[model samples]
Target: MALLDIKGIDVSYGKSLTVKNCSIALDPAKICSVVGESGSGKTTVIRAVLGLLPGGGSVTAGDIVYENRSLLKLSKGEWRSLRGRDISMIFQDSGAMMNQTRLIGKSFVEYIRTHESISKQDAWKKGAEMLGRMRLPDPDRIMNSYPFQLSGGMRQRVGIAMGMTYQPRLLLADEPTSALDVTTQAQIVRQMMELRDEYGTSIIIVTHDIGVAAYMADHVVVMKDGRIEDQGERGYILNDSTNAYTRKLIKAVPSLGGKRYV
Candidate 1:
């Protein structure tokens, strides 16, 4: 059985529809990237999976099933119980979402304590270790610093560290590398791939960059104007596309280290 199944889901803001009957089934420990241009409903799909649709937006039809249970049917409390434990998300500009008044360690410890029955001291230790794993130069100093004290890249890595600390069964990433420089983007992508390798976490990424899809996805789903334009294994999307939109996406990706897109 598929680990996560999104079947025939329709999302909307007010009465105007966005995602129309979009269906995707992801296997455990694999990466499936949802690719598209802006406003193509790529990020909407990620929000639906996470059940945070910005108030007015909602899943008006269809169901999201994780481990064979429908997420739409879950109560708010039930969903909360499952969200950070079984599923986690890496948001675009996640660092900017952090509270400026609190030290990074305070926020980190609080999150860990909320999710696990650990002492604040232990949570602090765990948070520091995770930061080190992300290759931060000084995990202790980072923990002691405020969000404004760190660089954009550092802040982004800290966010990634926080997201991966629990090692959830599934990870949702929304344009995780879009604002990052190429080198930092590559590093973050590699760290995420390592999480899949070391912990067998299933991942769904919403991105406009086909280069990121090519680097990390096992399966690819292309969206255009709020619909699935094309989908298949990475090889098929890269080497045997039958859709014009998919072809355009492939052509847009810059050649990497003399490696062809195909």
Candidate 2:
């Protein structure tokens, strides 16, 4: 069975429609990339899945099924139970979303404590271990510092570490690498793939970078104006697309610098 099934959902904020009749199925341990420019509803789709929609935004029609249960029908308490434990979301500019006044260790430990029934010491240990796994230098020091003390890359890695702290069954990552340098972006992408291998986590990545989507996704969906314009397996979408919009997207990926010959 598919782990996540988004079936013909129409999301809206008050009277304004956002996503319309969108459907995608994701299986365990696979990567699905949703590509679109900002405002095309990529982030909004994942936010709906995570039950994190902003005020006034709601799923007006259709169903979102996660592990055979209808997510749109879930109660607030039910959502709380699934979030952070069974599913997690890594936001764009996650570092900026952090509590600036709190020490990293303090907030990290609090996050762990909130999710799991463990002593603060144990939670801190787990947080530290996760940081180390993300390849952060001097995790001990980083943990002791405030969010402002770390570089953008370091903070982003810390965000990743926290998102993966529980090794959730499904991960919703919205532009996780868009803020980093190319080298750091590559590293983060590799780590996300490794995370899927290590934990059998299904991933839904929302990005505008076609290059990243091509490199990381097993399946690709292209969105335009809040609707899915094209979707298929990675190879087919990349090479054999007949849709003009899909062709335009494929051509948008920047090529590596190399000599070209006619």
Best by TM-score: 2
TM-score of 2: 0.96
Please write out the lDDT profile of model 2 over residues 23-61, one tens digit for every residue: 999999999999988889999999999888999999999
Q: Give the TM-score of candidate 1.
A: 0.95
Model 1: residues with Cα > 4 Å off, grouped in runs: 256-262
Write down the worst ten-residue block by lDDT for model 1: 253-262
What lDDT score is found at residue 162 in candidate 1? Answer: 88
Q: What TM-score, over all chains together, does every model reach? A: 0.95, 0.96
What's model 2's lDDT at 229? 96
Candidate 1 overall lDDT versus native: 0.91
